[model samples]
Target: MTNTLEALTVPLIQAPMAGGPSNAALAVAVSQAGGLGMLAAGYKTVEAMAAEIDDVRAGTLNFGVNLFVPESDPSDPGRLAAYAAALASMALELGLAAPEPGPFSDDHYAAKVDYLVANPVPLVSFTFGLPSADDVARLRSVGTEIVLNATDPEEISAADALNPDAIVVQGAEAGGHRATHGQAKEPSESSTHELVTLAREYTDKPVIAAGGVTGADIAQNHFDAGASAVQVGTLFLTAEEAGTKEAQKDALLSGQYRDTVVTRAFSGRAARALSNRFTERMAAVQVVGYPQVHYMTAPLRAASADNPEGLNLWAGTGFAACQLRPAAEIVDEFRSL
Candidate 1:
C-alpha cells in the first residue's frame, strides 16, 4: 500500500536540501523515525537519483524525491560572460581554472520525470517551479503524490492550477534556493507562518510549511496557521545522517556567523546563506541564470570545501537551533502533542 502524509504519526516533512544534506541515509533515518524523509534530485542525473531512491527503498517506504523544475532562458549570455570574467581572479587564487558558462540544461528535468513515471515513490515534490499538467498526470498514474513549492500569492495560484496533492509554502526564511519559478522575479520575504496564512486564501489543498522551523513552538504556530505539515531543512544541517559538508556543519555550530543573507552569489537564484567572503565579493557581480551560475561556481565551492568563507553555507534564519545529533531525535522534537 502507498503511504500517505495523513498516515504519518509525526506531521513533519524533512525539507529536501539539495547539493548536499538531503541523502539516502538522512531520508531513511527520518522516515524510520516516523517523519517523512526526502531526497533532493536537483543537480543530479537520473541514474544517480535512481540509486538513492533504491537506497531509501531498502530502508523505508515513507520517502520522497524533490526535483528542480526547468525554466526558460533566464539570463542573458552577456551577463554570464561578465560574471565569468569577474570570477577569474578568485578562481586563480584557488588554483582553479576560470569558469566558462556551460550550455543551459533543464537539470535533466524531462528524463527525471520519465524515470519517476516508470518507478514511482510514495510522493514527489517540485521546487523552483511546478511541473506541467501532463507531467503531473503521468506521475500520478503511478501512484506518486504530487507536491509543488510556491513562494508567494502568484505562485500559489499558479501551483493550484496544476492541482497538486499539496503545496509547500516556502517563505523568505527558507535556505537554499527560493522557489520563485523564475529568476526574473524577486523572492517573497514573508515569514513562514505568514506564508501559510496567506496561502489559505488561494488553494484548498494541504499546505506544507517550510523555512526557519526552529522547534515545537514554531511548528505549533505553523500548524495553527493552517499547515498540515512543517518542512525543516536548516535544523537538520548537522544531523549525523545528513551529507552536510564539514565546513557548513562547523559554520552552523561554530557560532562565528551572526546572520544569514539572501543573494544570488552562489546559484544566480535567490537563496539564504550565511555571511561569507564569497557571497560578499560575488554579490555585485551575480546575475540571473541558474545551473549556469551554479555550474560556473562549482569548482570554487568544491575547492573551498574546507573553508567556510568560500563556500555556500546555506542555512535558514533559525540556524542557531542546528545541532549534531541523530535525525530521529530531531524528528521527535517536532511530534504533535
Candidate 2:
C-alpha cells in the first residue's frame, strides 16, 4: 500500500483518543467507512498496543497508529512532591492512599518503535514531538508513512524539518493534551483554521487540521483553508464503536459539561478537558509534570472511572455537537468533503 493519506476515499481521520476512546473496533469501523481510523499508543504497553494493532490489521489495513513521541522528564522533584501532597485529600476521599511522585517514564517509545519497525503498518503518527530522523527513515523504509503533530508555526517548521510524510496541525482548541514539543511550553492560541493557514507557509507537505471538528461544515472550512483532511476526536467519543467510558460518553451527550478548559490537573500536562470538580480543585496546585503526574493520579482516576466529576472529561470546544451514534454515520457526515 502507498504511504500517503490521500488514498482515503473521505478526507477525514478519526483522531486517536488514547486511554479509552480509540480502539481496534473503532479503528476498523472508521477505516471500513472510507475515513482513516487511528489507534492510540500513548498510554498502552507494548503487548497491549501490539495486540490492538493485530486486531485492527485483521479488520483493515487502512488504519494508522499514533505514538507519543517520548519527552524528557521535565518534572522537578519538589514540584512533583508538592503536587502529590496536594492530592492527599482527594485520595483520602477515594479511600486510597496519598499520592506520590510517580517514577518518570518514556512510555516505552523505543520499544514500541522497534515493534512497529519489525511489523510495518500503513501509517504512523507522532505527537508531543517528532522522532529522530534515523527512526523516521527506518519506518519510511518499510513503507510506513510518518506523520508529526504540531501546534504552532515554530512547531510546524520543526516538524517540516524532519521531512515527515504529513503534518497534523493541532490547534489550541483541541481536546486532550496539546501537542507542544515540550511539556513546559504553552500551546499556541491559534484556531485550527488559523494554524492550517499558517502551516501552508511552513511546508508544502500535506497538512492535516485537527481540533474542534464537530460538524461537516467545520471540516469543509479546514479543507477550504488548505488542509488535506480534518481529524475529529471529541465527536467520535460517543461513537458506538468507541471505547470511551460510559460516564464520559454520557457526559458528552448529556449537555452536562457546558465548556472546556485547558488545565494540567489530570495528567500534569496542559490538556483541554471539561470543567469539573477535579479540575477546579486541583487547578491551582497542578504542576508541569507528565508521565509522573499522569501516573501519580492513576489511582484517583481509576477509583472514579464511573464519576464524570473526578475524571478528565476531555472535550473540544465543539463538544456540544457530539452525538452518540455509529462510527460510520459520523464519518459519512464528512464524506467527500
Candidate 3:
C-alpha cells in the first residue's frame, strides 16, 4: 500500500475543517477508533497550534496536521473597509459596537512549517494552495507524508508535479473553502465522483474523495469510484465531540436552511456555507479578498454568535444526515460500508 493508504488503519480520513470546527478531541477520537484523524491548523497561532499538537499527541500517536497555504496577494483593503462599514450597521441592529480592522496575516506559514519540521508529525496535508518544492522536500525528508487538496484536473496536474503522496480530490460539494491554487481561479463544477475519476486519470497516486460525503452509501460510492478513502467533514460536525458552535449546530439541524450555496461574502475566497440573510444581502457586493474580508467580518460574526439567523452556519449539502453521536461511532458507520 502507498503511504497515503497505509498510514490509515481504516479507510476513512476525517476532513480537517479550519476556523474552529476541527479540534483535538475529535481528531484523537477518530484516530482511536482506527481511522486517520486530522487537526486543522489553518487559523491558529504557532504557540496555540503547537499546544494543540501536544494535546493530540497526548491522546494518540497516529494523526495528521492540515495547513492553509498562504495566498500570494493580501485581500483588497478598500473592499474590506467597505464591507466592514456595511457589517457595522448590521452589528448596531444587534446591539454591538463596530469591529476595528485588525492586521491580518496568513497563519504564519513559515513559523508553522518550521515548527512541524522540528517537531515532526506523522502526516501533513496542505490545502488552499501547494507549498514550494523545498518545503515539500524538507517535510518528506523528515518522513512526513504530504497530501495536497485539488478540485480539478488542472490543479491535480499541478500538484502531481510536486510528486505528493496523494491528492485529496475535493469536489464542488465540499464545505468550507475551495482548494484552488489562486484566489481568482474559478473552481470546476465537477461532482465528487467525476473529480475523483478525473484525478485518477492524471496521476498514479492515491485519490481521496471529499465533498458532500455523509454516510456509508456515500463512502462506498467514492471507494467504488476509485478513491482510496473518503474524507468527511459535515458528517462529523454533529458529533458529540465536535467543536462546532452551539448556534451553528442548531441551524444545521433546524431544517430551516434547506440549501447550501457558494458565497464569497463571509471570506473573500468562495466557500460553501448555508444560505442565510447575511449571505443573501452580500451576494452583490464586490468582495474579492480572503483573510481581509474574513477579518473584517469577525466583529459581526462574534456579535451575532448568539443568533444563528445572522451568522454563517458552515455545513454541507449532507447537513441533514449529520448525527449527534460519538466520533468512534461515526468511524464505525464509515467502516461498515
Best-to-worst ranking by lDDT: 2, 1, 3
lDDT of each: 0.90, 0.90, 0.84
Task: At residue 20, give the lDDT of candidate 2.
Answer: 84
User: Where does model 3 exceed 4 Å of error?
Assistant: 97-102
User: Lowest-scoring 10 consecutive residues by lDDT in candidate 2?
Assistant: 1-10
What's the ranking of the predictions by TM-score, best on top? 2, 1, 3
Residue pairs with colliding backbones in model 3 are 268-289
Better of 1 and 3 by TM-score: 1
Candidate 1 per-residue lDDT, tens place, 207-294, comes to 9899988898988898888998889899888999999998899999999999999988877888899989999998888888787888
Q: Count the backbone clashes (under 3 Å) in each candidate.
A: 0, 0, 1
* TM-score (C-alpha, index-matched) for candidate 1: 0.97
lDDT of predicted model 2:
0.90
Better of 1 and 3 by lDDT: 1
How many Å off is the CA of 82 in candidate 1?
A: 0.7
For model 1, the stretches where C-alpha displacement exceeds 4 angstroms are 1-3
Candidate 2 per-residue C-alpha lDDT over 201-233 given as tens digits, one digit per residue, 9 for 90 to 100: 999889989998888898888888999888899
